[model samples]
Target: MSEQSSQGDDDPGEPLRLSVIVPVWQEAATIQATLQHLASIREAGHQVIVVDGGSDDGTPQLAEPRCDRVLSSGGRGRACQMNAGAEVATGNVLLFLHADTRLPGSTLAALKRFHTSRNAWGRFNVRLSGKRPLFRVIEWFMNRRSWLTGIATGDQALFVRRPVFEALRGFREIPLMEDVELSARLRLVSRPFCVTDPVVTDSRRWEQQGAWRTIFLMWRLRWRYWRGESPESLANAYRSDVRNAQEP
Candidate 1:
């Protein structure tokens, strides 16, 4: 092999080797800000890749400048778009982030530090960006449930080593609950290390839908899903109950 190729083959030890992949659809309002946050971590050998799932809202254009690579997905599903981003990403680790979520400045460095352990596949705790007191209660419950069950939601900023992600064949192509499904599969590899440093996420959904109602809806959906209801069915129910529920 050529010298450059040999050097590239060396494992990334004690350095940031992460790719922040944001799969978006019609996220023009938030994609730019999310990319900007990820841009700050690029100096640590981390890269950002935005996968636009056939967006018509200029999301790709806004992401092109702030992120390292912006690619258009052939389909419009969170799982499919995330897998597409991973296919072209070069980092050893992949972080699947949402367009409405913002990570801290130390996110890349934290991931590198966590990578030193065997359980590198994990997610950060989440904080909702809303003034409602119920948001706090909901976030606490979400974080606690995740820590206890070792199953993480997408809003938590799920991440995993590239090899393990590929081995698990990326996320299942489901209409909803893809993150939960991936976490279940990943449990065979390692229990997710829930980082306490929270990722701040937009609380518009909870606010618009009414926090208590949204919480109950989610619980019902999960219970039905656990009872063998198809993701498509759950997705339909979610859309009927929640405004802008089709969003990724």
Candidate 2:
């Protein structure tokens, strides 16, 4: 479906129209439930575009029925696929969501309340979708860190006014740390809204890799990246770690 056909006229009192763009790779494990949760926002008149990065796992097939449009991104990177989705988006605002994440039920209404201001970008706080006691502490730190730094992870559902996004030229095409790079640029223009309401992200990665180990690795990667290490090196190291985790 096209954006124009899906959109309604601007009601001065109504929320700004939103286009939620999700970039999916081999995410069949979680895509369906994520789409089902997003369906409410689409029903409320927002556009949901899912960009598939050549997922051999039939992600696009599953997403096509639930989304406004599911496009084959013909690429393998999240930044590339998300930029492709943003290209065809026709709403006043854009939201980049991860397929493993679920937004708050009241998110659209909350976005409506916040987007009316001069503030151009923001993100939701995030909760990891697992029952482990440590997940709560992780969630608190994630929210607090973002509050202090104005940087957002993809799991947080980063959103921005279309114009601001265009000005920044979207996420840089990189193998990793694209969210961090974009957040650094965005903060120069405006302070992020840092909505306290949280989006829930799948914690399977942490569970698979062991929570403490994953946390330590992530901090090490961030520290290196901030110290100007190349993303290619970081991505290679990350892939190696995940591969090792899956080996035995």
Candidate 3:
């Protein structure tokens, strides 16, 4: 590495060895609370990175104080936003968390502990935030199935060694299914750990779309992908539903 590159690599300071990178787009509604939650779990050598994907809703400003740095990336998709965050992250490990998700402080500690002991990357149990029985059923089944099968999603908050992540060339900069695509790639190297602690994800999408419709579409998408169909089609369906559901 050149001198300038070496200096840049060595100068991130000690407080940012493990960083939590949150990607946001129009998430002004929950960014502060999310950062506040992250800050409450203060640990040395940990930093929070908020990569705002051109949000016009003031989400970036809301994330400013609680995070170490806020970058404005010109991406209209999660894959690009998160990849941008990873590009600027100074940590040895990266945790890709969604803005609508919340993890208990203990789980963050568990991730660091697991990263240290097993010499493996990480994932978390997935729990949905809502009283819908379908949410409970899906969350439980998915968590247990992941435990048995090692499949994971971005909503579960994937963690990995910085070099391993970079070596894989990072997440595919697709419009959707980035998590599933990345998970499929990660499976080639090692099985993802299903942490006992879970990350709670908001379920406003389920509320907007009927539970059965949402679940059916998700299953159809998964089944299609598993049947060797291209994931891009399923991703397009998912984004369509998401856009329609989020609209007034």
Top of the candidates by lDDT: 2
Which 10-residue window of candidate 2 scores lowest in summed lDDT?
A: 1-10
| TM-score of predicted structure 2 | 0.93
lDDT of 3 by residue, 1-248 (tens): 00000011223233326778898989888888888878854445477898888899998888897898898777777888788889988888788999889986576556545554433466888788998677889888777766666667888898877888899998988765688788878777776655666789888867778777787887788788788776667777887877876678
All candidates: CA RMSD in angstroms?
6.7, 5.6, 7.5
Tens digits of per-residue lDDT for model 1, 32-148: 677777766776567889998898989889878888999988988899999999999988889999989998766755675556656748888899999878889999999989888
Task: State in Å the error of residue 164, model 2.
Answer: 0.3
**Residue 154 of model 3, lDDT score:** 84
TM for every model, in the order presented, reads 0.91, 0.93, 0.86
Ranking by lDDT: 2, 1, 3
lDDT of 2 by residue, 194-236 (tens): 6677888989999999999899889999999999999999999
**Least lDDT summed over 10 consecutive residues: which range in candidate 3?**
1-10
The parts of candidate 2 lying over 4 Å away from their true place are 1-15
